[model samples]
Target: MSLLSEVERDEERRAGARGDGDVDQPANAQELAAMSKLISGSGLLDVREGELEVQQRNPNSPLHSVKAFEQLNLSPKLIRGIYQMGFMRPSRIQEKALPALVADPPINMIAQSQSGTGKTAAFLLTMLSRVDPNENYCQCLCLAPTFELAKQIGEVCKRMAAYMPEVKIGYATREEKYTRDSYSNHHILIATPGTAQDWVMRYRIINMAKLRVFVLDEADVLIDQQAFRDISVRLSRHLSPGCQILLFSATFEEPVVEFARTVVPEAATIRLKRQELTLDNLLQVFARPASIDIKYQYVTLTFGLFGLAQCMVFCQSRREAEVLQKRLQSDGHDSLVLHGQMEISDRASIIRRYRNSEVRILITTNVLARGIDIAQVNVVINWELPVMRDRSPDFETYLHRIGRAGRFGKKGIGLSFVVDDTDERNLRQIEKHFCTQIHEMNMDDPVQLNELQKKVRK
Candidate 1:
């Protein structure tokens, strides 16, 4: 029930047998990274004297899973805030993570859980509880990979701290004007890596030494990208020695896991089993077009039939996304485009509209594969199936792409487009790995399309 492709699962089993799981190295790339780390002493981590330390979780020991938020001995005010935010009990990750995160000693945590599982809230509570709102100078700091995600974290933190008027959350994203040449009173700082790095190392506005809790949201992406990985390492060097470090992501390839250990070592760890991340809530299907251009036919037909439902159509390139959006718009569809090339402000504006349901279709690249949360998104179309940089089927990205639609236990439709045998092969591998069936869609069949409409309406 894992989300990995068949080939990656085989690699995982072999790597696990050897106890080395990290991401992207050699062309088979999987094996190269792990093998190199065990040998070369390269990358951010200076090879320790002993081989990389492995902290195995105790199978039976409970770190304290609570039936309710009150069981955690949280301040009554905090419990009220949780309930105010509509959280009644602890989610899987929250239950195991809250007690460890808010403990007196403040344990470091490395958590790998499915998306939409309340990881953001769990950490925000720990951060808010740790910060002294009365004497604020950016006591708690969280870094996400994108401005959209950083904003998302800020929104959740604000809601959870709504009752605690003294707790303030500030952003360090692009164009954020923080006090210069002066120390500020903001208690919580949410930002992306580059801006956060500049704020800490370059501008000297917020002192890293004063931070009590440091969080890296979507840590796998931070660790996977070289520029982000470098900034993360530099940021880690600036964190107060006592700062509680928390890293959370849905997918952690092996090398990224190794780097996570290097950055936040000897930490409490919580991970959902592989089966938990499968596409149980998404109705998976694929449509093969006679040619690449025919993908537009599928797109128009889908929107033409299900015009009211919000959907996200993922493309492999910015150009394709732009082209699709233009085509859809010309055809009288209210669609928007979100890709990496757009200006930050434009990107933020588009997401705001999409979240507010001002638009029905969002065509984009992998940028929206993970972070943004819009409950209205009930359909996901893989206009271009996700693939790794090396063009192999991207098991993790595929999981995240479809995950955008079937959010948090809601049923949704995930349709993938295959223009050639290569895509068909990749889709089959995805099916084999996740142990699920993706029925071939027959667009010409009126009855089948009607059934799809009914499923979506459900």
Candidate 2:
């Protein structure tokens, strides 16, 4: 059947399923029994096509089952630390790995799990489990690919250490001053790989004789850059005997697996895979046009009308990101631009504004796609396709872009404009990967345009 015909039939089926009885009728015993019988007789009463019915079937409802924490034969100090953070239950990943790390002889671990799955606390608890309050040398180290992520991991460490006395956690950045002695006295050192490497070479301050815990967060990004191997090599040269290493990231790509083998040779591996990580909270829609220029025009028009709390536009290059941001601002969109070429402080400030709702829209490259958490963002627009190693647009990048929205139990929308044969191929790849149907939202159709206008007006 044609797409329009299918949509129409679905709508008709829904209207018919409502039945002749008054929906607002009070539920007396007889009325309730009749309604139950009617629904049980036809699957139409249970199956729904809209967002509301799908939410009714959500497996991740707030009142959903809270997975219990495994009984790790942890010491009194570590149990006290976990309680200090007010964490009573473990996420799925945490439940599986905590006991293994706390056992008689700690085993190194490498985990491939999606973001927002509590990877931070899983590793933090393990690190805290190994820490000795009496020792002053850096005993645990967690390295992140970005300064922002390093700072976030440091904050998590602080929260976990609230009840523990005299335990210090520190992070380093070129923009910030951190004394070598300050880090020398820390029990946990959370740092960016670059900053950590700098400290290793400059101050030679890391006393690795007592260090026993090491973690690499977002391992895929570092694997892609070969920074994972470089950092692992440098760290191995300084690590104490019997040190335990952990590698964590969203995707279990092949390169990441190889890097993990070298870093944690006999480490236990865990994977959540793509199926579990795909966000069900997003409503994905595509807009197809006769040409790229028309696609650009439609994007400009739609974002102008959408008063979203926060929106991100993903482009292919620094030039494209800048030009698009300037054009949108000229059209009175008041958007900010971000990319690798900008200064560090400037990028952080733009992110702060977008996070705080000071700016409604941001245009940038893929750097912001991972490890940066902004819950208020509700819309993501793909202005340009992500290029893969084969020099073609990749579907995985598209998934990550759309995944940014509808996070943490909130509804989100993802819109993309496909304008050429190449774009069509990219769309097919996306559909095939998810086994999902991507509805094409026709901008030229008067009915759709009117509906969009009505939504924006409200």
Candidate 3:
């Protein structure tokens, strides 16, 4: 069974064990009697892309099925494009967000889903469905916090528009020049907010007269840095009347939601309480040592023994990333270094080598932890736990780090080395924050170590 289904079963068992009556249950029977009710009192999260239908294991509860493309009533061309992209399935966010987008009097969405849960595709499809190909006035403008993420959205939009004969996609970033004269023929503009905002202020190039949808991909980051006021709302001024706004991110905080509400008045809200696993099919393991030195020793040993599979090691700082890359190379490991401080070309080269499996292990910082897809990454190691304003690493960052390994439900492994009690505390906090149960196996355990060795041999 799928992890979601397993979680549902666990919830059911928990509910059954609670002898308390309706008073203890969060929702009343009438509330639960609708087409479906959420398992954990979180709203029904829609899932698409599979043959599964919404059905109840027992009559007392209602379950919402993940809506497939067939149920979505998407246009033939759109469906063909989605199929061409090899996305024969829709993610839970897409399933839930699409219907809500199409509903008459569109409901605004603020989804907290994992990065690779196909979140980009979900919003892009909605944008495409709402846009008019004939109207080439930047009908939809999607903003991302980082240049990399903006480029990613642009790429996806291009692919989804492949089957659509007339759609044109243009992206503007600090790196790419998309001026008024450059892409006036385009139908959609995917861009970093900083660059897009710069253009709007300079050329007024983005014609809001034809705009219909506005999307903020990494809303939390935008708000966290206090950059949304200058980045997001500046573009909001270019929106046509009654434009539907959507915000999707892996991490959700109260401040970000409040900021969103201020920008989008009269917006309906939906959040996925389950916090969709971005790293599905990933095996997360932690190595605990008596000290930090021992942690490094074990990691190096693991790397040396397993050879390599084009891995990524995440560090907390640019300096640490560089140092780790040097250390690994000195130890006779083929590796590269990347951080936001590096030139864009260097970053790109590192990414290319890593993707092509030319580089065995790439050391980087959080800049690589978001929206960068590397399919050949069979392993990811967190050399140092990320520091967040909160006590734990952002759940989204954790997912994104591990997500590098597994793509399209392929098996992958994420190893986090816990060197001290502080690391253990942080790990526990992360697991608790996400309500995920991660199994702990000792690298020192003879049986477990031997089993792992045997598997590696195969």
RMSD of each: 13.1, 17.2, 15.4
Tell me each candidate's TM-score: 0.54, 0.53, 0.52
Clashing residue pairs found in predicted model 3: 47-66, 49-89, 49-90
Order of all candidates by TM-score, from best down to worst? 1, 2, 3
lDDT of 2 by residue, 5-106 (tens): 455545533543554211111122222222222222211121111211111112342222224543676556666676666676776656566666665477
lDDT values for all models: 0.73, 0.66, 0.65
Which ranges in model 1 have alpha carbons more than 4 Å from their true place? Answer: 1-62, 181-183, 275-458
Worst 10 residues of 3 by lDDT: 32-41
**How well does model 1 score by local distance difference test?**
0.73
Query: Could you give candidate 1's per-residue lDDT for residues 1-458 as a string of tens digits?
Result: 12235686577556645655332121222122222222222112212223222233443544455667877757778888888887877765675678788887778888874345667788999998897878858898898877766876788788888888888788988857656633367889888888888888778767888889999887766766788888888888877779999987655568758878778866877765433444878888888777545767777788766545689998765655776788789888889998866554566577767776888889887766765556787788988788765557988888988887776567788999777777888999999978889999887779999988877677
Stretches of candidate 2 off by over 4 Å are: 1-70, 75-81, 172-182, 198-202, 224-229, 276-458
Q: List, residue by residue over 177-214, the lDDT tens digit for candidate 3.
A: 55567877677888877777776677777765567788
At residue 80, give the lDDT of candidate 3: 86
By lDDT: ranked, best first: 1, 2, 3
Each model's backbone clash number = 6, 0, 3
Better of 1 and 3 by TM-score: 1
